[model samples]
Target: MHIHASLRFPRRLVDRRLLLSLSLAGFFVVHSTHAASFDCSKATTAIEHAICDNETLSQLDSTLNEKYQTAMANLSDEGASELRKNQRSWLKERDACNADAACLENLFNQRKSSLQATTQQAETQLDAIIASIPADPANAAYQLKQYRGPLASAWLVYLNRFEPTSGVTAEEAKQRHQVAVTALNKQNDFAASLLKDIENDPKTSKNVAVLTFLRMTIEQGRYDEVPPRPDVHCFVFSRQGDAAYRAFGALWGSSRDSQAPICPPQGNLFELPAWKQLNKILDPVMSAAYPNSGTIRYASYADWAILRLRATLSPTDFLKPIEGQSQESPEKRISEWDDKSWPKVQREQLLIAIDPARKATMEWLQTERKFTASDASKASTAIVNAWLNEQLDYLSENLSTGDQ
Candidate 1:
C-alpha cells in the first residue's frame, strides 16, 4: 500500500532531453556567427525575420526528434500499448484515488474525535474515583494521592518518547495533549480511591475491582493497534449488563442460515451426509459449553454450516457469507440467490441448537449458592471458551475428512 511517487516518471529521459537541447543551442550560438548575429529588426519584413530564425529553429527541431527517437527505441510495442492503456485507465483511477484520499482524511478526523471522547469519559470516571476516596489516615487512597502524580508523569514521558507521530495538525496535537492530561488527573483520583477501598472494606472494593479490569482492558487495547476487533470485546462485556450485546447475538445467530448452505447438492458430490455426521459430533460439545446462550449456539451452528457449504460450493460461494455480511445495510428477507440470506439461515440454525442449552445452564446457575456478578462473568467466559474450542475441533476434523 505504500507508494513512492519518484518511481512513476523516467528521470533519465528528462535529463537527456534537457542536456541535448542545451548542447544544440550552445553549439549554434558559439560556432555560427551569422546564426548568433541574425538581425531581425533590419530584415524589413516578418517573413524575412522568420527566415533568419530558421537555423535556430532547425537545431531545436533536430534536438526534439533525437529525444523522441531515443525514447521510442527503448519502448517495446507491448510496453507502449500497456502505457497507453494505463494512461486511459488513469482517468478513472484518478477520481477513485481522490475519493479514497478523502475517505482516509475523514477516518482520521473521526479517530481524533473518538480519542477525545474516550479520554473525556476516562477523565470523568477518574474524577468519580477521586470523589469516592475516603480521607481516613490509614487509607490507601491518601497514600495513592501522594504517588499518583509521579506515576502519571512517568507514563506521559514514556508516551512522548515512544509513540509514533500521527501527522496530526498542531491544534489536534494540543487537544490530544489536553486529553492525556485529563486522563492523568483522573488516574490520580482513581489511585486515591483504590487506597481508601483497601483501608476500609477490601472484600467489597468495587473501585479496586474496576481499576484492575480497566488496567487489563487498557493493556489489551494497546495490543490492538491494527484495525481493531472492538466488537468482540463489546460482545463479551455485554454479557454483564448491556442489552445491545444480546440483540447483536440474536441478529448474528438469526442471520446464519441466510449464509450459503455447507451441504448443498452439486454435480456428482453431495456433502449433506458428512455435514450431518459432523453436526452430530459438534452438537453435544457445543451444548456443554454454551448451555444457556443463543450467541455461542448460533456461532457454532454457522461454523458447521460453513464446513458443509465449503464441500459443495465453490471457494467463491464459501466466501460469499463473509463478503455479504461486510455490506452494512438493512437486512432483507432470505432468498435463494441472495448472498445476505446465508447469515440469517445460519443464525436460525444456531438458535435451534442453542436455546435449550441456554435454558438448562440458567436453571443450573440459579440453584448455585453464590450467584454474584463475578461468578456470572466467569461462567460466561468459560462457556465462550469451551464453545470456541469445540467449534475449532469440529471444523478441523471435517476439513481433514473433506480433503481426503
Candidate 2:
C-alpha cells in the first residue's frame, strides 16, 4: 500500500525556542543557573571560584556548556568520549590561568567556537544519513547500526531497552536507564523539531510515521503516547496491524479471559490493506513470539503483530485439515481447534499454507530477528504453545473481529 496516500497528518507549529529551552533543561545533569553546569556552593578549585565570582564568566561558562552538550548530543560514542576527554584536558589548562578573567574568557570563546564547529559537522553527517534511509517499515532496527554518535548510542539503548544486563541489581539497571534517558533527553529539541517538520510535510509524513511506529513498536512495544489520529492509525496498522487489532479488543493486560497475545495498542487501526498484509505473514508472525506480563518479543513485535492480525482477520487460515481426514467439515475443524486437539500435523499444514512466503519469513527471522537457520527453518517453535493458547483463548472470547 502507498502509505502516504492512505494517511494524513495534522500540522503543528513548533516553537523552536521553547523546544531549545526544554532541551537545555534536560541537558544539564545538575540544575543550577548560577554555575549553569555545576553547583556553585560546592565550588572548590580557583577556576570554579573565579567563574562563580564573575557574572560574565559564569554566563560564558553556561553558553559554552550548551554548545558542549549540543556537540556531545550529535557525536558518536567515541566522538563524545573524546570530546569529554578534551574538555577535561582543557579544564586543567584553564586552571593555570586562575583568576585571570581575560585568559578565561579567551579560552571559553575558543572552546565555544570549537564546540559549535563540531556540532555543525556532526549534524550535517547525521542529516545526510537520515536522508539516505529508504523510509521502509520492515526491519527498522537493522538500520540502527548505520547510525553513529550519542544519538546512535541513545537509539541503541532504545532498541535494546528490554534486554537484560547481566549481574546488575535492579537499582543498577534503573541507574543505567537513567543514564540512557539523560543522553536521549539532550536530543529532545532536535527530535521535536524533526517530528514537527515531518508532521507538516504531507508527502513524507506517513512514510516517516510508519518507520517511526515500527521502530517504537520494537522498542517500547506500543506507541500509546501518540494521539489516535487517522494517519497515526494508518501507519501503525501498516506495520503492526494484528497487535493493534488485538489491543483494540482489550485482549492484552491482566484480564484472565484476554486470549489475545500481548501487543501494542492498535487505536482504531483496522483496515483492509493492513489486514491483507497481516494475512500474508500469519504463520511466522503467529509462531514468532509469546509475550507474557512485563515480557516482550523485542524486535519480533512486528512479526507477532502480523500473525495476530491475520488470525483476527481470518481464523480459518489457522484451521488446518487433519491428516487422513479426506473430507473435513467446518464444525469438525472448529471442534478440533476448540478441544485443543489441533494436531502437530496441523503444523505441517501451516508450512504448506505459508510455503510461498516461507523463504521471505525465514530470511526475516534470520536477519532481522537474528534467528539461527535451524530456528528460522521451523518458523520458531519456541513459542508454539503460546500461539496455540492464544488461538484457543481468543477464539473462546467470541469476538466478531475481522476485515468486513
Candidate 3:
C-alpha cells in the first residue's frame, strides 16, 4: 500500500491559529513563539547547557516552562509560591544534570509525567506548546528518542477517547468511535503536510522515524474506513497476558466470545529503523528491569495499528484455509517431494507456494525495504532455516506473518 496518499480531513476541531500558521507557497515559514525557563545565551549549568546546545531540547524546555507557568497560574498565592520554590529546587537538581543529555532527558520525562493537563484551563495554557511544532521537521532528528514517551501518551489519549468504556452502550460507543475516526483522519492530514515536506528533502526524509510517524498517522486514520462491530474490541498486538505466545487477536476485556486475533499493521525496514531509533535501540528493547510487564517495549502506533487493521479485516484468517487454497501443512507439502506418485504440477505448486513466499520476503527486504546486503542475507537465511526445519506450521497457522 502506498501509505502516502492524501485523504480528506475535517476542519471542525482544528485550532484557528494552526489554520492560519500553515504556509505552503510563502517564502517565509511562520514560526510559533515559545520561551524557556531561562535565557539560552548566558553561561549556565549542565542541563541548561544541554538545552542551549540543541534546538529540540530548547523547544522541549520552552514547552516545559510553559507547562509550569500554567500549573502555577491555577494555584492560590500560597500554592503558587510553594510551586515556585519547588521549581527552584527542581532546577537545582536539573542543573546538576549539566551536559548529560540523557540525564536532562530523564528530568523532562519526570517533570512532564508529574504535571497534569486535565481541565480546559491547562489545555488552553499548554495549547501553544503543542501547536509549536517547528516547521518541516515535526520531530527533530535524534531528539525523538527523548520525545517517545510524551507523544505516545498524547496519541494514546486520542485513541482511548474512542475506545468503548464500561457501561457505555455499544451503539453509543460506535457513535463515539465514528466521531473519533473523523478527528483522527483530520489530525493525520495536517501532519502529512509536514511529513510530505520532510520526504521531499533528502537530508531529513531518510530519518526513518519521521516516515514511521507519518505512516502511523495515516494508518490510524483508517478509523473512518473501518467497519463497525457489535462487540467492543481491544486489539492485541503482542503475545502477552494469558494468551501470550499466540498470534494476534482481540483480547476481550469483558469476554464477549471473540475468537479471532487482531493483527496490527507491519512496517517495512525503512519505517522500522526510525521506530527503533526513537526507542534508542537497534532492536526492540525489552524492559526486563521493569517490575510489572515481562517486556517493557512500547509498540509504536504503526505496529499496533497494522495489527488491529489486520485483525479487524480477516479476524479468523489464521484458523481457516481459503476454500480454493491448499491447506496442506508445510511438512506434508515438502514430504510430497519424496513421493514418486505425486503429480508434477502439484509438487511444483507446493514448491511455488512456499518457496516463493520465502524468496519474495528476501527480495522484498533487499529491494522494496532497502535492507543492506548483509542484513538482507542474514534475514533471508533465517527464513530459509525456518523452511528447512519445517517450522512452517507456525507460519501457516499464523497466516504467514513473515520472518516473525
Cα lDDT tens digits for candidate 1, 1-404: 00111111134444654686798899978766333123544766433344345554333323433333222222334433553464355435433433343443343344345333443343343333333322221232332222222222222222232222312234533443343345433434332333233324445233233323233223322223343322222211212222211111211222232221122322222223433443564454334434344333454454444322232222222222332122221112111212231243543454354434433333333344233544534443333233333454433233322111
Worst 10 residues of 1 by lDDT: 1-10
**Each model's TM-score, in the order given?**
0.19, 0.35, 0.24
Runs in model 2 deviating more than 4 A are 1-33, 135-150, 153-404
> In order, what lDDT does every prediction score?
0.33, 0.44, 0.38
| lDDT digits (tens) for residues 309-375 of candidate 3 | 4322322332332221233444444444333323345444444454444455456566755666666
Runs of candidate 1 with Cα error greater than 4 angstroms are 1-138, 150-339, 343-345, 367-404
Give candidate 2's TM-score. Answer: 0.35
Clashes of each: 30, 5, 15
Tell me the deviation in Å of residue 294 in model 3: 39
Q: For residue 117, what is the lDDT in candidate 2?
A: 80
Query: How high a TM-score does candidate 3 get?
Result: 0.24
**TM-score, predicted candidate 1 vs. hidden true structure:** 0.19
Q: What does candidate 2's lDDT look like per residue over 238-291, in tens digits?
A: 334333332222211222112222344232222334323434434332343232
Error of 3 at 249 (Å): 17
Model 1 residue 77 distance off true place after TM-score fit, in angstroms = 76
